[model samples]
Target: MDILLSAIFSSEEEEQYVLDCMAYLMLLMAAWTFFCLLSTNVPYGRYAMYGHGFPVNAKFAWCVQELPAFLVPVGLLVWTSAAKTSLLTNQLIIAMYLFHYAQRSLVYPLLIRGGKPTPFMSFALATLFCLYNGFMQIRYLSHYAQYPADWITRPCFITGSALWFLGLLVNLHSDHILRNLRKPGETGYKIPKGGMFEYVSGANFLGEITEWVGFAVASQSVHSAAFAVFTIVILRSRAVGHHKWYLAKFEDYPKTRKALIPFLY
Candidate 1:
């Protein structure tokens, strides 16, 4: 166990490591995301019928959409290390990954109650992916400690940090609102009315994307930028799908609202 942990955490550098690593990570994440979308049933659509008691199709969109979410970070870790960037970037990336995993793996599952059985195959594959990512991210961050002392005071950093905090607040609050809307043993869709929902259908996803985009800008790394771009691609697609679903389902749904963006799409 100790050896496995060490291997996951340790970083070995080669020339152009950062760029290469980021590229590979992005590719892997993109691939995995695509597979998830293709292989498993669409949770939202499936839940609408079995879990939420709404009628929806269970079609899998193109597999490409899945790749960006996971691959980007994986690629970033590899490329950043190879490029010999500062440990600060590595630490930040790792922290973000772990933080994200905690939410997706730990908190998300808990929020879900007894409903349609989540397919074991899908659950197993997703769990493995999350575990692998969690280890890699935490390991890299643990080894990374030093940062530019003035990073927090810099304008870019300040702005980025503010965006990150805002995103976090929106994501958390949006999730809270959704969870509260559904009572125990109740199965049906409920419009999230408060918080960022007033502006966008997938406000939670938008918040998460914004958070990472801020991180990338604050760190000023190509690796981070790549991750941000990939995130935007995947989440935007999901947001668009979600927006259409909302419009079709709710007659009183806000017509003026965008998909992922707040005011303008």
Candidate 2:
């Protein structure tokens, strides 16, 4: 009887230990991600554009900022896999991280075209947010954070995927509209007038916020929820600023459109 009791207690202890370790690792990853985000933003601010024509100062800044952003994600990936030895979790994280990287590294840079560069501060802040999010997402994925096996079924996954994809499309389209609003040698900003833009002045920001919210719901993780909250706080501020800027700049700009949300904001 005594031996049986000892075995039971030991098993419980081991399980709890594993859970505690996982929690600690998740927190560590989140912290590193935050640091990388701040570091990345500092350099992103210096660059005039996405491509090679950036000034020397901007180039140096980019070099400095890029390191931690790359390192944090890579380190988390390696550590989580080693700790859990879970290939499925590793694959999920890598796939999601790659998807985001494709958008940031390839799509965003291509979209720059000949328009005036985004404000240095804007780029810096945005990059920081992106890096922070990127790390959080990858860490969660690597941990296989999910609802109970039966909680979410195929149908739910399908619906959630649709929402996520739609949000991404809206975000990309809104960004394109804003980028193309200015041609070479044109300086002033214009009110974006397409897609969700008709509904909200900060349609791009709204789209992105929606995108991550959808992701968090789909993923069903506290880490993802935290990321969504942070995104909302930052983007909401930007949207308000943009709303005020538009109102101040153009007399003809519609008063009906909200800063971020459509209709009910």
Candidate 3:
């Protein structure tokens, strides 16, 4: 029995050590991503730069890259005893994370309307990101996160949940508008006019930023905050690029529309 107990304790210690190292690595990844995106945009689809490797099916790339976020977390939760679903706070937090990935990985790809191929390098990097972040987030929540039983009733959680819901709605609506922008056999891009598009040139990007901001607020963890910052850095820059592209392409592109934020650049 002593030998068994020692082995169990040792295993637990090793698990924790691995997770702690991953947390720091995630932080490093965020910084690296920020720097790369700062210097050059994320290479995918039309924005993809040279030397991004060969092309892959856009839908396949998206699904494979994104699935790790949804699957890895759940696998960790089920296979490990670190995070239990019995806690209301944990349940709610995990649910929110899973919801976003469920849509992104499973639902969103099916809705893509003739998207251009994704670069292999872009797909590989995205896959690495989702897997790294998925494990880091779930490990933090299950093993390290601490919250009171009544934490869900707090103002932060309440406001964050509301914001997340609103962002989800706006994001889905904006995507629908974008998908319908071009009908069958029509190739040209049109200005997305409805929903949040009227206020921001990149409504989808804004929605994702809002979602992560709310996520960070709700989690109140440095890890979540890092993820949120990373999201903003990448998406905000992409939005700015798209805004410029639109202006260069269209003579009547909205002059008042901001890149990602509404009423403010």
Identify the leading candidate in terms of lDDT. Answer: 3
Clashes of 2: 0
**Per-residue error (Å), model 1, residue 260:** 0.6
* Prediction 2 global C-alpha lDDT: 0.60
lDDT scores for all predictions? 0.59, 0.60, 0.83
Candidate maximizing TM-score:
3
**Candidate that beats the other on TM-score, 2 or 3, i.e. the better one:** 3
- Model 2, range 1-265, lDDT digits (tens) per residue? 3244346547635644544454455456546655555433322222244553333333333433343445566666665443332554335434544554566554465555443434455445545755665565564565445444443455544455556667788888998898789777787667789899999988988878877676666665666666666667656656766787789889999999888999977
Spell out the clash pairs found in candidate 3: none
TM-scores for all candidates: the values are 0.66, 0.65, 0.91
**Which order, best to worst by TM-score?**
3, 1, 2
Q: List the lowest-lDDT window of 10 residues for candidate 1.
A: 56-65
**Alpha-carbon runs more than 4 Å astray in model 1:** 1-11, 15-19, 22-97, 115-147
RMSD of each: 7.8, 9.1, 3.2
> Candidate 3's C-alpha lDDT?
0.83
